[model samples]
Target: MSLVKNLLVSISCTTYNHEDYVTDAIESFLMQKTNFDFEILIHDDASTDGTSSIIKEFEEKYPDIIKPIYQTENQHLKGIKASGINVKRAKGKYLAVCEGDDYWTDPYKLQKQVDYMESHPECSLCVHAGYVVSASNKEIQRYSRPNKINKIYTAEEIIEFGGGLFLTNSMLYRTELDRNRPGFFEKAPVGDYPLAINLALQGTVYYMDELMSAYRVGDSGSWTVSSFSTIDNKIKHFDQISIMLNRINQYTNLQYQHVITRTKKRIQFYLLVEQEKFKEALKEEFKFIYSEFGYKDRARMFLQGYFPGILMSLITIKRKLNL
Candidate 1:
């Protein structure tokens, strides 16, 4: 057994088929200018695309800084999440994440987060704004909240934030938060959001306004891109979220019942719409996904769900008239 000692922070990085971008991630970790000792615990989940080999190359170069778990077979396919597995191996007081595709842009990112976490005992989690870079790296979507710096986010607020207040790559949280993680994390098929919420329940999480990272979107190995592009996958994902929320509600003694239930309903409504079972969606309460859709879109949803034939006829007529 390896002794985990004298580590101030552990960077939990999980990679699978990210050979194209894994080096940037590792270099980011190695470039941090911090006064404290930190370890990078990497897990290459049996990537067939030379991702594991790339990780091995880095491990050989920086054996002291990088500790890796190279799986023979895909662990993610067997319901094991890389962050969860990495957390179990992490020995530092604080844990940070930057997946294979995502990389830290600021060298002071670790130092800044650690300085704040050490100073503030009440904070269990710390997050910062990140730029969303396209796979081509030519375009970026900004995630800045200049007015909300050092804002303390509550458990309820994090849970109801609908998944985009911060990116997983931009988080630095307490390692002990792993101890309070619910069993659903092992099987729920989603991470980050639930993990953040779990930490928020123990202590309030804070946010920094600075952009310290770049989150790679539309990358080949991006889970968000792959998960929601297909109707079947989206429905399956919602079903998993439903089970996860049920377990969370049970664990919290129904404290987040209303919010979780509303979240579940929102997922279900979209699943129904994707499946063209809109009639069923119209029967349930509507929660406006203000972030993704607007009033006219909602009206169109209702029309398509309840009056499919009429809406189809209108669509055909509009196309014929070039309107």
Candidate 2:
């Protein structure tokens, strides 16, 4: 067992075949210059690539600051399971998360969130805006443009926006709240949204408008990646959404109606596509379309139902050509 320090924060970083970007993630945490004590708990889930080697190098260099939970066999899709195990081992008041594939860009990111949470005891979770970077580490999309500061958001607003209020790399939460509820990440293909929702249900959610991290997109390791790019995967995605909605329904004090309605529309759209009922699906989707989206998206969904297969293909071709 490692010597216990008066650490107030513990960053739980889970990695699998992230050799290309793991070094950046570790350096980001190590560069933090705060007055309070903190440590990092790293889990390398038996990655076949050089990810384990990178973690070993960091552990050897900073043995006291970086605690390693290295596994010998591949854990595969059980990455979240392994992460939960490491979280249980963490000894800190707060648990800040930054997966190995993603990294924080600001040195004061930890300090900012810690200070806010310390002053506001009513809040249980803190998150910040982030930018989407390509696999090659180039900036692609800004998460929340035209603004860069912290903003407090309510649970109702988060639920209305489809429950993606915070990214995994930009999250910090109380450890005790998570310890009381085990298997928090067991149900979904990903755990970020579920974790945030659970935390929001307990206390207020604070949002930092600053871009503190760069999320890597277009990576094959991501859950959103299309394996077969077939209708089956689309249908499966909707099914998973349904399961998430059902789970949310079990808990009280949550604005679940909006989530349920949006999920139902998504499922209807994919099912219609699968059953060749595009017209009916479009008519159903119109009822759920939020005003926030642009005209092109609404028109596209509407056209998907009205046009025949041949015309739709031509529209797709034309759009691609224009792009």
Which residue pairs does candidate 2 place in steric collision? 149-209, 150-209
Per-model TM against the reference: 0.82, 0.81
Task: Give the Cα lDDT of each candidate.
Answer: 0.75, 0.69
What does candidate 1's lDDT look like per residue over 180-297, in tens digits?
A: 4677666577788788878888897888988899887666547876786677776777787788889888889999998887767666665665576745645626534322332233
TM-score of 2: 0.81
lDDT of 2 by residue, 1-323 (tens): 14436688999998888999999999999887676778899988888899989998999888878998888876655444665766798887889999898898899988899999999999989888777688785566435321245567666544434234456788898888777552434666556666776787789889887888877867876545553245677567657756776667666434577755664665465456556664564463444432222343323332232222433533443354343
* Residue runs of model 1 more than 4 Å from their true location after superposition: 1-6, 142-148, 269-284, 287-323
Best by lDDT: 1
Q: How many Å off is the CA of 320 in candidate 1?
A: 24
State each model's C-alpha RMSD to the native: 6.7, 6.0
TM-score, candidate number 1: 0.82
